[model samples]
Target: MEQTNQIERKLKLMHVVAIGLAYMSPMAVFDTFGIASDISSGHVPAAYIVVFVAILFTALSYGKLVRQFPSAGSVYTYTRNVINPYLGVIVGWVTFIAYIALPMINALLADIYLSAGFPEVPGWLWVVGLIAIITFLNIFGVKIAASVNMLLVIFQALVGVIFAYLTIRSIVKGPESFIPIGDIFPSGGEVPELFGAAALLALSFIGFDAITTLSEDTINPKKTIPKAILLVAGIGGVFFFTVTYFMQSLFPDVSIFKDIEGASPEIAVIIGGNLFLSFFLSGALFSVFASGLAAQLSASRLLYAMGRDGVLPKRFFGYLHPKFNSPVANILLIGVLSTSAIFLSLEAATSLINVGAFTAFSFVNLCVIISFFKHKGPRSFGFTVSSLLFPLIGLAFVVYLWISLDIFSIIAGLIWALLGTIYLAFTTNFFKKEPPQIAFDELEA
Candidate 1:
């Protein structure tokens, strides 16, 4: 019988980190390995190292901004408060589309994998069933969703561990010695290939930033959220580099795989035969489940933040269930939206993701630089590097990745941005007024 407008703060640091890891999907290293190895000329881990640097600097920017204005809006909240309110709405709108698209990608992947395994079952059935289970858990409670993600993430780590054991054992039993140091670094004329692989690998780190959207649901968000962001990025990076380092050492080239595009399944067969391949594929399916759960949770929290700020409809988007104290309305809306996966191609859904992700990454870094100059902090070496230099480097790195995107992604992103601009114009009466600001202090209180 009790109703509340606020989302409850119940998640601790570990829970938040778990959801973030699920969102990143550590098993993804296998999915990306074949192509990245080919591009890096047999140095996937080095490419991971290249992308991790960019991710580390950006994680620092996220940490700095979350300390100043910790809210469920993530990059959207940061931009609105630190930069301009109107700009924040546009950023939020663009990122909203991005978050919404993520669940669809997971759903599509699930459908493909499941349908491949169960030939008689329809693909659309898999998509709908996957979304339904994820939405049910999310609406049950954020804590429940986080717990599920933790278990799923643990399972993924187990699979990675087993795979690594088999790979290392195989290499030891073979003729080639483990070239630990040499293979991870590129030789002359391979820098371009390494960067190219890094650009592709950058998308894998999207979930670390998504953790910021859980601020309202997190205890001591200003401290917990920032630390959780760094932990998620750092942990995921280490897991990725460790897995690929061994894989690169074992194969040393993409020519070994039958199908480079779908090499992970084959790699499992080669390493441990059919028995381990089943476990690997099951791990991949569970990963899709984990990712969809976290994605919907983040997307709903974002909508709730914007709704509370009057950037979207207040009644529906901002509403929390009286019993569960979760964002029921927004969660269901995303659940409904996820059904679009049945109609969308995986490539199309995948392309839409990078545009929104890169935009948020680039802007969050820029927001840090803007905040540094706007709010005069103590003139010290630590503050200068943390506030300005780190973000500048992060910005440059994101710009490089942004330009590396293919022409289709660029055009799709522009079209999405244009739609957001049109909606913003209508909301603000053609730029006569600024968008409403979120009451961060009151929310924390």
Candidate 2:
């Protein structure tokens, strides 16, 4: 086995951009081409406008939060400062689950893609292989991970662009033919149901906030974090809408929801573009690879910070590797939990993940709104309030999306909150005799 060196805090701005890029890839193309197709019914691409606008408000809030704290614990640290301490712990726990669930889904999809090539090899092997590779890179530290992510983001971007451009450019000869600019619209339906369907499918476009989770580790966190987020949303939005529209144009017969093998409507764009199955599968694999790396990197840092705050078991959560300077214990814990989740219920996992991520994103946004009001020093923050409750309106927008999530997701989120509460109570009871607990980093030094 190779011994890893401790990682120095030498990661620069472009590396931070790599983090945003790779982190955005996991579900970016998948949802854009897959999930977006489902609700779009030709109108789904338009919903990108709504999702992008909503994300702008959310990004504004996160930008403010990261500027305040240039340390780890992106959501947890922000929520802790803006809200109650207990709420912070709950937010951390749930976000951990969210982080884990995303990679699990991606890994599963990756394995499925692998299984196609190697019938002799089990799908689980590739999944575990990906985990081990990412874990090793992360333990080596962020800079190396960021370097790998740069290559990955490039690959995903190229594959996606090529797939889209080919489909669009070749539309003249492909089956069903590409719809011109005028074809993007709803045929006929209730306004409420149409919008709701758009919203339901729009959940796929939620990776920009996840990209913001790396805010704590960035150079000039405020400027870098906001730019990375806005970049992800802007680029992701335009790209997603373009491919989805072209795919719809290429396949006039297939409904977005209809499931079929490759060369069908689900994959009509690739099929029409004459892309080999190899490219499609490779792209999916790359998507999940980026997903796993980003999740493990961000989530490990989350645990490291939470432990430092004395919110969890310090021995497990707070222990940093002397040799690697990575949160070894926390990384192992997250890996085990995520691996265990491979066989668990995806519906439950997805719902829980979505709600947890949604809440954190909402809170991060809400905190920004509060921070601006609280510390509006001259030119303090953006946006002038025309109404008495401009802040309230922003807060309400976040909360409404937070509630619109599935009940299963809410229950899962609440369960994690309760667990955090229970653990806090136990720790308080056990440490009753101690005057004060030492910090994790203090123990390390």
Candidate 3:
């Protein structure tokens, strides 16, 4: 690839963090609060804590690997370089499921919001329109995408703060009192349910790792990318916990929400009334836009990485626009895939995401462990704990979350993995040859 046609390095730490938060969609705590609360039996905060703690370990593992292998392929690059080339191809292929499905999920959410607001307007129009706008922004350049997401993320944070304030005020004024701290914590027997809820909420934490996919686009990725990952996870975790604590405190009774999955708007109305509802809805739509933009951006980068390495058709997937220096073809392809959102439901799209998420998360941690053994490091306690113990804990949490997935997602993920294996075998001539590898030395130069 020519230098002029390559992805440009322009992102700073703030840009990376903004994109990560946008991808996570800070308002998501409101959107998933009802369902997660129901699953956790009104202990939404507890579930957030569970997921956040698990993700912290994984984030550390991601940080550890990105410093060594800071490429756009993320876990794919780490696993492939640390482990076997074939396994790396498989991990990359499976992780593609989450990357591709996330934009579709955002499209679905935008359609739902727009359709609810404009009953006379067609829903498909909203989905198509939103996808087109985001696709254009991403194709223009990653810097533009990151900038737009930064603005939208700011709006989302403002809404979260206002919603929290209103919810706190509402709780103080209402006849019902806040639940005791002890009641907010789950019992030993309820640990399974808590984990189940945490599994679902894992969808909200996708952004932290997604930031690693911008390794090539980020300035000083070895330092900036790793710090951004921790910042994203920490900021997202604190925001989610704070917002949900008030929300769970405000509405202990889930019965008030007529539709559990789509309860945030209702909660918005109760706390802030029609005016705040309008504000909340607007923010939610913007959140969807922000998320879709970042999701498509990350997905395109991953495809570019795979394509440049010949895992996919390099001519189509690896090609970057000479002027924009963006993966134009990959961005367009994801835009087309997002059109499937018009035919799919939110639950189905969400179900596809976690399968890939857990797979990538598990492998990233494994990469850290594998890399630790493959290389020689000091035998000090701190290095040993970080390199070995942390990843092991992260891997353990991933296993629990994987087991907590519903039967449908589990089966679907298995089928997806099998398909990837078949494709890998075909590409490698039934394991007779080694899989193609990304030239990090060339990329670094």
Q: List the residue pairs that clash in candidate 1.
A: none
Among the numbered candidates, top lDDT falls to 1
Best-performing candidate as measured by TM-score = 1
lDDT of 2 by residue, 5-99 (tens): 21245556567666666766633444444444454544555565556566566666666566666557778777766665556666777777777
Better of 1 and 2 by TM-score: 1
Ranking by TM-score: 1, 3, 2
Q: Give the least accurate 10-residue stretch of model 2, judged by summed lDDT.
A: 436-445
Worst 10-residue lDDT window, candidate 1? 175-184
Look at candidate 2 and give me any clashing residue pairs.
Answer: 40-44
In the range 1-445, model 1's lDDT, one tens digit per residue, is: 5446678899999999999999998888999999998998988898999899988999999998888887889999988887888888888888887798899999999988998899899889999999999999999999999999999999999999999999999899987567668656888799999999999999889899999999889999988988999999999899999999888888887887889879999999988999999999999999999999999999999999988888898888878898889989999999999899888888888888888898899889989999888875576888888889999999999999888888988999888889988988998999898888766777672
Ranking by lDDT: 1, 3, 2
My TM-score estimates for the predictions, one after another, are 0.98, 0.84, 0.96
